[model samples]
Target: MLFYTVMKPLVQVALRVFFRQLEVRNPKRLQVPGPLLIVGNHPNTLMDPLVVAVNRRDPIAFLAKSTFFQNPILKAIMESGNSIPIYRRQDVETGAEKLTPEQLAAQNEAIFGRCYDYFDRRGTIMIFPEGTSVQERRLRPLKTGAARIALGAEARRNFQMGLQILPLGINYFDPQRFRSDAFLNPGPTIRVADYADLYRQDPEAAADALTEEIRQRLEVRLVITRDAAEDELSQQVERTFGSHLNPDDDPTTLYDNFQLSRTVQQGILYFEQHAPARLAEVREQLSAYLSELRQLGLTDEALESGRQRPGTRLSRAAKATLRLVLGFPVYLYGAINNYLPYKLPSMVARRATKDAEFVAPIMLVTGMLTFSLAYVLQTMLVHHFTQDWRWTTLYALSLAPTGFYALSYWNNLETRVHRLRALRLFRREPARTAGLLRQRGHILQLLGEARAAYLAARTAQRA
Candidate 1:
């Protein structure tokens, strides 16, 4: 609560000074006068909760991973923010064989019970269905935890409690960067009646229904700048499900557990009919939507595409010259803009994909410059005030970028690498050279194939 007292004002002051404008929506709706369960899509690390806190005065509690609670300082900060701890019982790597059906059911019931109690008491709880942050464009397949909470709460109270679950979409222009653009968009609240009975009979399905509804709402509100084409959709599906496929083993049956239905197929077809005029916008919207779904942990197969071979020496020379001519400025601006946070007003920073690993060299360079400037200032202060250079030299050297790099080497490096890998998928330009028309045609073909596959699988599964 104290952190909120100091943090909100500081955030406002900082956002005002750094950004051209700060926009917020649904601030009033956040103060729903009941036991509120604020559910959201996770996008940024550490920043998601802050955005929600900045919008309200209430002492909201959030469920954070148990690992963060291990650190005394971090635990204090989280506790101060009124965050609850969620402990995962099973070791993720032990695989399904390690758990019996009975054990899994017991664990689910225990978690459900805890969340239900919290919601019943009118305690505000924040949960990220995706469980982890991806690039905010699409949501991953959500864990059933949120659904369990909502359903369990409904069941325990016989769907009569004044409990409301608010669907929040956290949209970040550039996550993992300071002073970036973000919007805390809220959707209509879900009532107990929406899924109480369904949950009582089949909690898993009820949760999926709730998540799908949230996904639909999120697709409309969270504005993603780039759009995906038909081909890009294939690529997205590939990226999502690529790891699931095994080169050594081919399965006889294809599953349709996570797929769009025939009605959605018709809707997508209708949208594509006007794709020429609205393709860019629609593609972006769909891409953003699918990206969110991906974050929710759904696995889709990767799209298959062929790589074009380089031409003769003359053609190669021409290509090299073209790349050199165009790539230099983009690269130069990207390198220089590394000094600024990706969230800054500078177009250069904004254009660069938010890859934390790529930002390291930039941070290191900027840190060196900052340290040098500080050292010079401190040296002058010491010479004028005390005639002693020892303290100045010690402080300056200790705070240098090299020292900071050494300190952050083991941990920050891994985090940067992980983020870089995640962002790498976004950097690819699947439609860059195929010519817009050709790419669109390819995408349409792929979309048809995906739909056929999904329908066939669904029909077979039902049989």
Candidate 2:
């Protein structure tokens, strides 16, 4: 408890610094006081728990796979983070295959006993019902451990122990990328008391029912697709339409994109059921537009406003040029000062791991360590050369803000470059640019028409 108390603030700070935008929706849903079980999808391995843990006001104990505790260092870290390990049959490696069924039962029984005790004390526990992490839009089949644990604990206390199971949907916008966004959407709480009578009669049936309910609730909160292909198309459509809808690139744009994807999926399903041919035509148009965008090296934003008037184009170009000219000196200084610390994590992660899901956490932890060490070393060098503690302190303090400025400057520079390329294409190849613009306009028109038709069909069905 003491260890968790000490580390919570630091962990929260680290998470805030790691992700560019972390939004928690419906946080009030978690405010109910009682024995709580946080169940969520596992998309990123270690990072998933941390994201949830840091967001909540109360500390949450997590059930982690026992395999992670095999390493002494990891075991210590997990223990410090208030994690309980559960042995899984799939996690047994090599020699562990020889373990008898009795032994496995004994281990899990002990874990469950501990869980019941924790719940009795009105403590909060987090479990990934899916049991494993995978980067996918759809939720995998959830295991019954979470439900069983909650029900078991409540049963032990004659259903007097108020246990609430909160379903959360963790949505990552490019999970593996640095400075990506993550949204935590909390669903309504499932009260264990509501199912106490059923559990008393048949425990297994009650567990299954609760598990299915959790899955259904999570599915609603998540941006789940039918399959991988649909997921891919949804992402592409999101990127294109998002640029159109969210021109300023607000932080909430990611969540907005998620909602947009859900609507698109429904529209596609509507077409699949009633108008397959129309759906195919719409898909082809979308694919062709995306292909043309790729070929021209242009983002959807480039086509927004559809071949902007010459005056507007010139005005935007002038502003971008002015920003570049004015910000260059500060950007240069920041780049030079922060370059090594910034680049090392990405360089190392690219070489070290093949799994894309692991990359962001690796980069975040690695960057935290490397940047801190580098800053200290730079401070020491500055002190050594100038022989003034005050100058060294000033230099050390400037590292963070300047580094932040460099990151902002880099993003702005990239935007400017993209706009410049679009402007140049507009000037050099007017006919081709105009053709692409017309194609984009046609695709948007088709999508809008299809959406209207789908909505009309739904209205007619209801009528």
Candidate 3:
């Protein structure tokens, strides 16, 4: 408990720095807690637990794969963080498989006993029902461990304990990207006590039924598609049309984006069932429109207001030029002061690992350490050379704000460059630009029609 209290603030700060926006929907639902079991989908590996852990007031002990405990440093950290290790058949190392079936059964029994004890003490335990992390738009078949653990604990106490299972959906905009967005949506709580009667009759049957119910509830909150190809199309549609439907510039809250994605998925399904030819034509048009945007280095927002008038284009150019002129001095200062710390993490990650899921966490941890160390070294060198503590202190303090300004300046610079290129294309390649605009118009029309049809069908079904 002491360790959790001490580390909670630090973890929250790290997560805030790592993700640009982390919004937790219906956080109040998590307050009615006792011996709570949190079940969430795993898309990001270690990052998933970190997200869930920091959101609530209660300290959560997670169930982690046993292989993570093999490393001494990591095991120390995990133990300190109140994590429980669950051994899996796949985690048995070759030539190091020491535990036989009986021994493994004993280990699991001990683990479950510990879980029951923890519940008796009114602690929260979080488990990823999917058992493994995969970066995809669909949920995998849920394992029965979560349901089993909850039921076993309740049954052990004669169904008197108030144990509840909370289902959470972790939606990541780009899980492996630094400064990306994530949304934590909490579903309705399942009362373990309510299932006691069923468990009393048939344990296995009760576990299966509870698992399926949890799966159904979780599926509603996630953007699950049929396959990879459909998932890709749904994502593309969301990226293209999301801004129009959700005009909020803040990326911190992703509920709106998730709704837009769900709507797109529904539209895709409706088209496949009712209007295949129309769907095929629209898909081709969307593909071409996306290709043109890529070729011209443009975004959907650039054309959100439709084809720009000549005066509006000229006004935008003049405003952009003025911003460049005014901000150049600060940009230069920031770039000079914060170049190495900003670049080193990316370089290290590129050379370190090929796994996409591991890259973001690695970069975040490495970047935090690198920046802190570099600032300290730079401050000491300044003091050594000038023999002035005031200047060194000022330099150290200026590091963070300057780095933030540099990031903002770089993003603006990229946007300005893309806009400039787009303006040039608009002026010089009138024919091509016109054709692209026509394709955009067609795509929007199709989307509007499909959205209407989809909503109508959904309404009829509900009615």
Candidate 4:
């Protein structure tokens, strides 16, 4: 509890910096008082809980897997953060104690009893019902433990606990990346007492029914993909022409992007079943176009820019170049001051694990340490030379803002370089440049036709 109290503000800051846009759709739903069982799909390990926790002011007790408690240091941290361990069969079988199935059941039963006691006091509990974390856009078959616990807790209180289960659907636009986006969609609360009649008749069937309802609620709010192929195609389309297609996209939130992803995925699935030939044709053409763009060290942005009038293009280029040159000194100072702190996290994270889901959290933890240490050391060095507290404080404050500015500057510089390369290509090889632009135009044309047809089909289906 002491640890949680101290870390809450830090976690909020970390999450705010880590994600570019993280919008919770139902802000009021999170305000509902306990006893609440907050359930979510786990796409990123460790970070998912932190993401959910920062959204609410109240403390959320998390249910962690038994393996996380094996380490003595981690065990203490987990306990202090209001976490309770739930043993899984696999962990028990391979654990040092090697407990029997009977022992495992007894342990879980005790945990449920503890949860019931917590609910008696109206404590909030967070659980990932999907049981395990995997970095993908699909939900796994959820375990029945969450449902059983809710039902058991409610039944223990004679269906008068006033407990509710909140289902949060977390959509990570790019989880592993540093400045990615995420959208959180909260589902309506499910009162455990609503299923009291069914539970009395058959507890197991009641749990299944409740779990299925939870699944449906989560799935509808999530951007679910059938497989890798469709997900890849949709992502490619998004990166290339998403802005062009979604002209009215709101930058403040990623809900529109989430819907766009879901719609693109649905369109892909529709074509797969209804017109395999058209799907295959577009997929091949898209792959070839992207491959060529990569070979030329260009993006779809360059091809589209080629279509713009020369004066308009060069005028924009001139302004960007002047800014790039003027910002060089500040960018260098920031790069020098913040390079180690920015780079060390990713370097350490790669050596730590190969799992995609674990990368972001480890990077985040490592980054917090590196940057804190770097700032402290840099501040002390500045003070040692100047012996001025105010000067040192100002220097320390400038470190982070300048670091962010450096990042933005570098991004702009890269975009400028790409544009320069594109301009050179267009000048030296006019025919080749025109061919690429024409090919891109044709690709969009095909996409437009398919998009219209698929949208019409969707509308007709709904009608």
lDDT of each candidate versus the true structure: 0.54, 0.82, 0.83, 0.89
CA shift at 397, candidate 3, in angstroms?
Answer: 2.8
Q: How do the candidates rank by TM-score, highest first?
A: 4, 3, 2, 1
Q: lDDT of model 3 at residue 444?
A: 80
Report the number of the highest-lDDT candidate.
4
What lDDT is reached at residue 114 by model 1? 68
Return the top candidate by TM-score: 4
| Model 3: residues with Cα > 4 Å off, grouped in runs | 1-5, 93-95, 246-252, 303-306
TM-scores, all models, native as reference = 0.49, 0.94, 0.94, 0.98
CA-RMSD of model 3: 2.1
Between which residue pairs do clashes occur in model 4? none
Encode model 4's per-residue lDDT on 375-442: one tens digit a residue. Answer: 99999999999999999999998998899889999988878777888888999999998888878878
All candidates: CA RMSD in angstroms?
15.3, 2.3, 2.1, 1.1
lDDT of candidate model 2 versus the reference: 0.82
Summarize candidate 3's per-residue lDDT along 201-312 as a digit string, tens digits. 9999999999998999888888778898788788888888767545663565578888888888878888999999988987888888888788767876665433678798
User: Which runs of model 2 end up more than 4 angstroms from their true locations?
Assistant: 1-3, 93-98, 243-255, 457-463
Q: Taking the tens digit of each residue's C-alpha lDDT, what string does model 1 give over 1-463?
A: 6666665576544444332233456567787755788888776655567667767667577888655666798789777777776655443224333446666567557755766776677777788877776553566777767766776687777888778878887665444453334566677887857787687788788888887876676655554323344435434433333323223322221112111211233334544553434444535644654554356332122111122232543364465456555655544443332333322333433355465423422332233345346557655766677666787665445433333233334333344334333323324644432332254345455445544554665588799
Off by over 4 Å in 4: none
**lDDT string, candidate 2, 108-223, tens digits:** 89999999988888889999989988888779999999999999898888888889999999999888877788989898899988998889889999999999999999998898
